[model samples]
Target: NAGVTQTPKFRILKIGQSMTLQCTQDMNHNYMYWYRQDPGMGLKLIYYSVGAGITDKGEVPNGYNVSRSTTEDFPLRLELAAPSQTSVYFCASGRQGAEAFFGQGTRLTVV
Candidate 1:
């Protein structure tokens, strides 16, 4: 079941440009999360949702937005991109005590 899928494996955005990173999971997990990793750093949570229609901010919520309208999809929106926003973004889903399934990742570069 395509555990977790992220679209546009890679992208480059100019300063001030905006884009949405798409993620979808077929595992039917109720918990979904968005995270970002900078070079030589651990993943930092960006946003997460316990279930559809319920979302919460994480460590770094600035310049980003997310929504969970269904169990299968969670998209991350970046507005007015900046160089500091360049990083590898990941989407994950899982149960409370189970291991999470992560997407291949989206590498974004803000120039």
Candidate 2:
């Protein structure tokens, strides 16, 4: 089974532009999360969903949104991208506190 996948492994967006970073998993996990890892930094949670149709904001949810409409997919949306948003975005999933599997990641840069 494919653990996880993300499109456009790297991207450069002008300020105020928008984009969606897609993530999918075949593990049928119940919990999915979005986190951003800044250069030489630890991950900061952006959003999470316990199950399909239920989602909530996390530590750094500004300028970002997420939705889990199915068990296999969760995508992160960025509106009005800013330079501060330049970072590596990772999509992860697991059963609660279990070890979360991560996607290869999408590196985004806003100019």
Highest TM-score model number = 1
Model 2 per-residue lDDT tens digits across residues 14-59: 9999999999989989999999999899999999999999999999
Each prediction's RMSD over C-alphas, in Å, is 0.7, 0.8
Clash-forming residue pairs, model 1: none
- TM-scores, one per candidate: 0.98, 0.96
Give the Cα error of residue 22 in candidate 2, in Å: 0.2
lDDT of each: 0.96, 0.93
Model 1 local distance difference test score? 0.96
Worst 10 residues of 2 by lDDT: 1-10
The collision pairs in model 2 are: none
| Best prediction by lDDT | 1
